[model samples]
Target: MSLSFELTQSIAIIGGGPGGYEAALAAAQLGAEVTLVERAGVGGAAVISDVVPSKSLIATADAAVAIAEATDLGVQFFARGGDGRPLRPQVAINLAAVNKRLLALAHQQSEDMRAALVAAGVRIIDGHGRLEGDHAVVVSTGPGGTDFDRIEADTLVVSVGASPRELPAARPDGERILTWTQLYDMRALPEHLIVVGSGVTGAEFAGAYMNLGAKVTLVSSRERVLPGEDPDAATVLEGVFTRGGMTVLSRSRAEKVERSGDGVTVTLADGRTVEGSHCLLAVGSIPNTRGIGLEEAGVQMTDSGHIRVNRVARTSVPNIYAAGDCTTFVPLASVASMQGRTAVFHALGDEVMPLDRLRITANIFTAPEIATVGWQEKDVTDGVADGIVHKLPLAVNARAKMMGVRDGFVKLIARRGSGTVIGGVIVAPRASELIYPIAIAVDRRLTVDQVSRVFAVYPSLTSSVADAARAMHNVGRVAEA
Candidate 1:
């Protein structure tokens, strides 16, 4: 790839999520005139409603979990007890204040993102944007609005993102029945909360509310929570959820949710009904692809309604690229941000690295957050990949022992003969942070020996990663027995 585009080439990015804003900055840095059109805010759902807000809420819950274990650290919570029963910790969260802070953090992040884009000379348009024809995008304030403008660009990037999917029978009143977005508006935690769907979103909220002192019931249609995650990782997470008092109704599908007097009634596919103070629908997301003039502009879409795009994020229509949740791939903010940058590089005729579907790292914000990168068990088991796996318990790590963390582990996968690190999974406190080195090892094609040689701080949880890598280096010798 060679740089060939003119400096004055105009690049218009529609949508203002992580993908859109990131593409705007990248394009501007390359001296392209960039115009970003957004309806809600510059940071889109990633900041305003979905990612940031949810993570903020999760932080509070994680703190509660940490404090509940303070007694183990010789920190006294109550006077030497009268009852024979041991004192278990408790937390009382003010949902009103918690949500208010979450919204504030979201707004601040949006403003920060907008400021960064503007500072980089990207024009920000506050309105809905749609393709006018082949080379122009029309921006309007909204439906039945007057203020509008048209932007003509040599290249267009669509990062419109996605919205929460809603079922007709289980409509949200933004009160008892809620979507993930409406969760921040809650004035009080649901006394007996029922979470539907056991994907990353569902598992995250279910674990979060349970930590925050809510009696949580997780309704899973699959055999386990986080069905798309690594199987062993999912098992560890399910064990943690169960131990934390969450009711996991695995293989029980929720067919409908309806308001029943002061609470909500969730009817299962088997005709079993579970009543709770509130129900949260995390059945997954629908791409924000409809009514955007995507098809009218000659952008081809898949049968499932996702935009058709190659690894480089290019749509069927020339000069147009799509990224983020709008495209058919794992819908994660990290991937969206990467695709956004890739689109900017490719569209500008600059030397570009195409997105590789395999070398992706994903993190779930559940307690003892699950993070994974690269090839999985099925891939190796099905003969699609040749690799060896080594799993090490976090309980063996000095830091984990000191922290009283008896659960979770770090697993490594490496190519069979070459011993090249191909994948890794971490299920521990702040596993998101611990998985980065493994991700880098997988992406850079580093060998198990190389990973084991990397410096790991003594008495730290991260050392478990290097320990797993070391075990993989000796896996062949161990396997022979």
Candidate 2:
């Protein structure tokens, strides 16, 4: 897509996370004078700590799980000692080595993003930056933040990202009681980990640790895991967690976390206590919009300190914009990147597509991952949308049985009269990858018949998606009739 106008304008961006980096690149490529100010190098927390390292750790956990599951597929290993007796070893995770590798990977990704930005003619500044009114950004640079640099631009974009939310009663001490960011510092896996929160982050870590051969206890304030996700998907995951030896405490609210000798104790609201070698807080995150001069610059903000930006990512102030976790939008890295580019395109007179929350795709990285896009089953049940839902179990799929996969299902939601695919849910291994076609169906507004017509590779997991769509086609027809 080409810009409609010449790049005579100057653009300044703060926070070099996915959103800031993308905005800088898009603006620079459009011939604008672009300057990006970042405090924690390029790629920000998403690369340096959060998404990259965490997902890499999950990949290692997946490998461990695969090794354990290999025996079910006729794969076995045996060792003999001096006495010639057969010995079998258990699957173990070298957590220190895994953490080192993932951290290195994160750092490498950060450097790669930095290099790309530098090569794109975007001025990069390593500093703490804030809005100096609407037209310029002031950055604290040099040793001890003793020096300052200012960049004046016609338009400004803020993508400062966010940090893990810390509860006052359950403060993370970074040792036995820790936040997700500090989890990688452990040299060995905890003997027992108590994860507070049943949200995506908490569930992901709890399942990952369990798969990596660690005892895990997940504390959820709600009755079920993944409170607002698809009910069937949540039930499947809860069963998986229980079968995998994960202790899930539902309807349990953690009141406080205290460091005991060599371990930690979590006190629940019901006067019950859970003791574990380590505790991880996955409650939520707070936008890094505090003391950033957003309010002074006439930018509207939410009660939680999140900047309020329109669909085009433009803030209340016409010349200023915000994206990523800092803005009041979906906080996924992909959404942030799109918001970044959209902000630049709209600001620079390029053709822009306003982001729609309904079309967003989200995936939970847990054992038997859960992925969803567009409308959900709850939406139809709650009368929020006119739709029909159909479900097909993966157990019925030829490939799933061959792969020794016993759980998971494909669910499709379509408009009642038109049969246009509106939403979908996938529960399976690598559901992250499997959900893409469903996302495409949602984005393109493809009818169930059109989706069913798309030939899927035989004896493959994706064929379940086609099957689900085919099942929904009849449902849609009956609804119309």
Candidate 3:
């Protein structure tokens, strides 16, 4: 089906991540000529160096962990030892093959995104796009390089995304001290990986490497791992990581990282040092807001250098908008895409949905993923919400039991008076997929009773969600009685 629009304005989108690409498609589909400027491939850092590649690597690591657990399910392996002793079970990984597969998947995603954009009639300019004026941009090949050309647009969409934050004292060499983006280039697993930071990215890499047969040490400046996540879920993950042979150092800040011959040493702020074969710095990301002429064009930015945009993704300047990690909103691919689409919709005079942070669902892709949507339990505990919390453990679920999942649970928060489901948390395998139902409920403002009435498949992991909803209903009844 072809979409028709009466507007004849052209839009320029800088960056090619989910936000930039999705906005480009939306604008083009709405009959606006779109030009997408990208320094890298079509899918930006999320597809090329970060999300897709990291997740693909995790997929192989997950398979290895599954094989290790197969013995418990009566799957035995026999291996003849070189020393004449029979080895009952052994698990091995070809790091080269795994890296190849990971890169292959990342490339496939990039190609798919390119094809989609091309088919949608969005012109992709291979260069760094910077705003030359309030209504124009110059695409450059490199820093201080020749200006390829300039394009003027009626509207501009800034989705410049972000880069790994590097400390001056702990600069990554991409060998011993590495950034998260550099991990994809490694063909061999580290003997021991020391991951600095306990945020989502740091915890995920630390967990993935540990599962892939590498001893992992996670250093956190906070009191606990995943300090920003739900406290209960964080506690559960911390326990799981410890049981999985991960050394988690809390309240430790990495002040410096330096190469020590073949290995690396990370110094803590408290005069302690940890040595490992490799060090992965996952401190955070810095928004790609510099040298974009944002200040000259009146685009307001936060103190941290993230672009400040309104609910419709509009910058302080009327004709300019921003989205993705470059904005002050949560750095999530899903949220970025929504912000991009919303920007395009508003620019084209279409119906625009205001950004709703409460409806956004986010996941930390650990061994047992932690997915959360809507309000958090801490909000209720802190009297930030007029709600009650209900939790159901996966150990009580039939499917979880069959799948040998002893850890993990689903927790739901509902409004005390209306029983309206406000938020939920799922800590289990494939929690990313399982959180969608809760996301939909939160987005549509569905009640707990409405969620409980839905017929979830019997003996499925999702039954835990339904059970949690049902528990909420029962608790409501007890409160009224």
Clashes of each: 0, 0, 0
Q: For candidate 1, what is the total of clashing residue pairs?
A: 0
Query: Cα RMSD (Å) between model 3 and the true structure?
Result: 1.9
lDDT (C-alpha, whole model) for all candidates: 0.89, 0.94, 0.91
**Model 3 misplaced stretches (Cα beyond 4 Å):** 1-7, 80-86, 142-144, 475-481
Candidate 2: Cα lDDT at 444: 97
Across residues 259-378, which tens digit of lDDT does each residue of candidate 1 receive?
999999999999999999999999988899898788999999987679988888899988999889999866889889988998988888787888887799888999889888899877
lDDT of 1: 0.89
Between candidates 1 and 3, the TM-score winner: 3
Number of the candidate with higher lDDT, 2 or 3: 2
The TM-score measured for candidate 1 stands at: 0.95
Scanning candidate 2 in windows of ten residues, the lowest lDDT window is 1-10
Task: For candidate 3, write residues 175-268 as lDDT tens digits.
Answer: 8889998987777889999999999999999999999999999999999999999998999999989999999999999999999999999999
Pick the TM-score winner: 2
